[model samples]
Target: MLQAHEADIFRPDVTVLAPQEAVPARRERFATRLSPQDLERRAWKRRVNTIHVNTDVVVKAVARFDQMLADLADDVEGQCLVVPAPSGAGKSHLLARLQMRPSLVPFRDEVGPVRPLVFIKAPSPCTLKTLGLALYVALTDLELSATLKEHDIWRRVRHQMHAQLVSVVMVDEFHHALRGRTGDERRALVETLKNLVIPDPNDPLRPPGAEMRPISLVLSGMPWLRRVLKEDFQLLRRCIFMPIRPLGHSAACVKKATKFLELIEPRLGFPAPSGLSEHDMVQRMLKASAGYTGRMMHLVKKAAFRAIRSGAPSISQLDHLAFVFDEIFELGPHRNPFRVPDISTCPKLKEIEFDKLTRLMGTAQADIDPDDA
Candidate 1:
C-alpha cells in the first residue's frame, strides 16, 4: 500500500527522491508561507507523480502478465503479448513499471554481460528500416548506416540482439506502424515485426558465432492494434491479446475507488481529515472519473489543489469538486458529474460513454491553463 505522503512526485530533472526524504520535505514546504499563486503551482506539480492504488484486479493482472513474460524469457520462445487499451487507461504506466523488474536486468554470461530486456517506442512513420535502426540505436547507442538497405539494417539488428543476449523486446505505441498505410503496406509492416520475434531459418543474416535463441516480444498500444494483428495470421497466432478496460460501474468498483480515495486523502496536506470515503462522495467521484483509474486520480489531484488554494482544510463535499471540474473542463452544470445531485439521473452523464470521457480529459495537466497560472 502506498501512503499519500509516500507517493512518487515528478521532478523537473527527472530524479526521484527517496520516499522518506520526499514526503517530509514536501510537508515542510507546504507548511511555509507563500503567495497563493505559488501555493497553487506547488499543489499542481503533484499531478506528475503517480499514485499507484493497488486494487486486487490490477495487481493480479500485472502479476499474471509478468509471469507470462518470465516464462517466455526462460524458454526463449518467439511468443508475444499484446496489451491494448484506450489512452489514459494506464497501459504506458504499467509498461514503465514492468521495465523495473529485477528479472529484466542484465546479467553475466560465459560470453560477457547479457542484457535481458530492450524497450523502444515504434517510430512515428514506422518502417522496417526505421524500426531496425531504432532497435540498433537502443542496443548499441550508435546510428545504423543510412546507406544500408532495409534487409541489411535488420541483419545488424539481429547481430546486436545476439551480442546483447536480449530475451525480451517491448515495443510501445505499436499502432503507429499501421496508421495511414495501405493494406499492402500494413501487411508488409506486420511481416517485418513478425520476423523480429521468429526469424527465418534460411535467412543469411543469422549470426554465425551466437547461439540461436528465441526472443519474446511485448507490444502495447491503443485499441486499433487489434486491427493490425488481425491482418496477419502469424502475428495473431504468436501473441496473447490482453485488453485493459476501464473499471465498470459496480459495487466492487465503488469499493476499490473508495479505498483509493482514503489512501490519497491523507497525503493532500489537509490540516484535518476529509470524509472522502463517505458513500455519496465516493459515488460522485466514480461517476466523475467514469471509472477510469487515471482520470480518477487526476480529478482527486486537481480538487486537492483547488482546496489548498482556497485555504480549505480538506475536500469535503460535492460542491468543492464541482468548482474544480467546471473550471477545468468548461462543462455546464448539467454535464458535470460533481455538479449533479444524482449522476444516474443526469441525462448528459447517461448519454456520454466512458471512452469519450477518457478522450476529453486527455492530459490532466491540460486542465491547468497557462494564463490562469
Candidate 2:
C-alpha cells in the first residue's frame, strides 16, 4: 500500500456506519405532548391532532344534531341538517362527539331494543363501491362484529339496523364524495345516500320526505361543500343547511379558545408551559391566532418546537406568533387576518371594509361648458 492512511480499505467513515444507520434522523411523528403509547390507545388521536377545534360553536351544533336524530326516531320527519362550518372549525370533531353523546343512547332505546348508531368518515376512494365499502368498514370499526360478506350481511344489517329503531348515518368529509368523476360515480353517491336515506324497495320505512332522501344524515365539510351542493339546488333544498362562521375575538370565542387549548394542553406539554399566564397569554394567543382554530394550533405546535429547541422549559407563550402574522400575513394594528365574526349574544351584521378600496371616477365626457376642462 502506497499510504495506509489513504487506502480505500482504511476508509473509516464509509466502513463505520451501515447504510441504514447512515440515514439522517427524522423528527418524531408524535404530537407535541403525546407519549408514544397515547397515540396507539386512541388510534384516532394522531389523526385528530391534525384537526383544529372551534368547540364553542360545535357544542351547540352537536346538540341540535342530537335533537334532530331524536326527532327522526320519533318519525318527526326532520329535514337533514348540514352543519357547514369552516375547514378548521372542527367539523369532524363535532361529528365524533355527536356519536359519543349521552343523549344519543335514548334514541336507540326508543327506536329498538338495540339500535346501532353508525358514523362513517368518507374515504378517498371517491366511488360508490368504495364508499359503501367504507361504510362497512366503519361499522366493523364500531365493533359490530359484522363482516363485509357473511351471507346476507346487508340483509342482517338492514334488519338489525332497522330493529334498533334509529340508525343515524353521519358522514364527515362529505366533500370527497361530492367530487365524483363520472355521472355513475355521482349517481352512485346519490343512490347510496338515497338508499341509506330514502327507502329502498327492501327498506322498512319510506324516506321521510317521500320524494326526499331519508335516513337522517348530518353531512359536513368546509364552505366549499355548500357551493358543491348549490350546484344542484333541487338536491340542496332537501337539506337543512346551517353554516358555521369561524370564530373571531370575542368573549364567547375566548372561552372556546381556552377550552380547546386545554383539551390539547395536557397532551402538548402543560400547565400550558411556564411563560403562559392563563389570563394574559390566552388573550394574547386569541389575538395572535385571529380566531382560526387550525392556525392557532399550528402556531402553538410550532412554538412548542421553538421552545423545545431553545430549552425554554415550556413554551407558555412565544412572541413568534406575532412574527408569523406580522411578517408573513402582513397583519398590522387594527387589521385582522381572519374573516370570522366577533362573538355576540345577539346576531350581528357583517361590515364591509370600504375604506380600503378606491372607486374610479364616472367615465362620461363632460359637456363643453365654457372651458371647464
Candidate 3:
C-alpha cells in the first residue's frame, strides 16, 4: 500500500532496530564492556525509532480509513476521506500503519496482481503530470518517459489502477497540490482530482460512454486540503473530513496525555523512570509541546538525551525540559514554554523561525513543518 516518492517521503517499510547493549571488540580475545551510560547513548537512538504511541485519535483515523476501503470493496462508489491536520499531527505515521496491514498488501489470486491500496506522497510543486506519474510508478514496474504528455500519463495511470484492482489510492501531503498557484491552476488541479473519485462518462480520458471502476481516495495533509474540496460542490459532498484535534487543558485530554507520557517513559534510557505521567509534568509537557503529539515526543527525546549528557539520573524535573526547549528551539527563558511562569503567556511556535528550528534540529523542514510558508 505504501509507495516511495523521490522527495519528502517516508517509506512505511523502513526498519526500526531493537534496543540492545553495545560491546566493542578491542585486541584479539579482548572485548571492552561498555558502561551503562555509554550503552544507553546508543540504546536510546534505537528505542526512539521503535516508539509509536497510538492515542485515540490515531485509532479512529485508522478505523475510518479501513471502513473506507471496506466500502469500496462492496460498492466501488469511490469516496474521499479527507484527513486535515497540522504538520506534526502524525498524518504520515497513520498512513505508515495502514500500509503495514497484511490484508492490504499487494497479492495475486485467481486474477492478476491485486493491489488493494496504493500510497504516494504528493510531489512538491505538484502538477497534474507529476501526480499522474507518481501514481503510475506505484501501480506498475514499467518506466515512464520524462517527456510524456499529461493526458498520456494519466491514461496509463488510470489503466494501471484498474488493472491492478486497486480499491483505494492514498495521497499524503495533499496540500502541496494547492501551494503557490494561481486561481486558474488551482481550479484545474481540483477538477483533475475530482475525476479520480467520480469519473465523468463524457470525460475524454476514458472511452465515450464506457463504465469506469470506482476507487476510493484517502487524502491526508494540512488543513488547507479542505480548500481543494471546496473548489467543487460535488467533491465536498463526497468527502468525509477528519481533523486531528490538539490536546486541550481538559480533564479527559490530561488523562490521554498522561497515558502517552507513561507509554514513552520506559523507552527513554535513565537510571529510574521519571514521573512523566504526574499531573504537573503532564501540564508542563502540554504547554512545552504546543499540544502536538509529534512535537511532544520530539521534546521528550531531546530532553532525555540532554539528561544523559549532563549525567542526570533522570529527566525528572521541569528545568531539564526548560533547558532543552531553549536550546533546541532557539528560544530564551522568557519565550520557553517550559520555563515561562504563566503558561498562557508562552510564545506560540508560529512566531518563531520554523526553517531555523528545523536547521538546528538537523531535520528536513518538510518533514517537520510542511504546512509552514
Local distance difference test, each candidate: 0.70, 0.51, 0.73
CA lDDT, candidate 3, residue 82: 82
Worst 10 residues of 2 by lDDT: 354-363
Q: Native-vs-model 1 lDDT?
A: 0.70
Residue 319, model 1: Cα distance from true site in angstroms: 8.3
RMSD in Å for model 2: 14.2
- TM-score of candidate 1 to 2 decimals: 0.72
Ranking by lDDT: 3, 1, 2
Q: Give the TM-score of candidate 2.
A: 0.53
The Cα RMSD of model 1 versus the native structure comes to: 11.5
Clashing pairs in 3: none
Alpha carbon lDDT at 362, candidate 1: 47
lDDT of 2 at 322: 43
Candidate 3 lDDT over residue span 1-373, tens digit each: 4554643366457654344322222243475678887896767667765678887777887788778776765663578888887655567777787677776888887878889889988887667777888888888866699699988888787777767777778898887777666667767777777776787777667643446767778888777678767887777788998787788888988888988999998877677778888877788778766576766777787777777767778884665788777777666878777777776777666613444543444423333334444
Q: Please say which candidate is ahead in lDDT: 1 or 2.
A: 1
Task: Give the number of colliding residue pairs in candidate 1.
Answer: 0
RMSD of each: 11.5, 14.2, 9.8
* Candidate 1 wrong stretches, greater than 4 Å: 1-48, 73-76, 106-114, 143-148, 267-269, 305-312, 316-328, 347-373
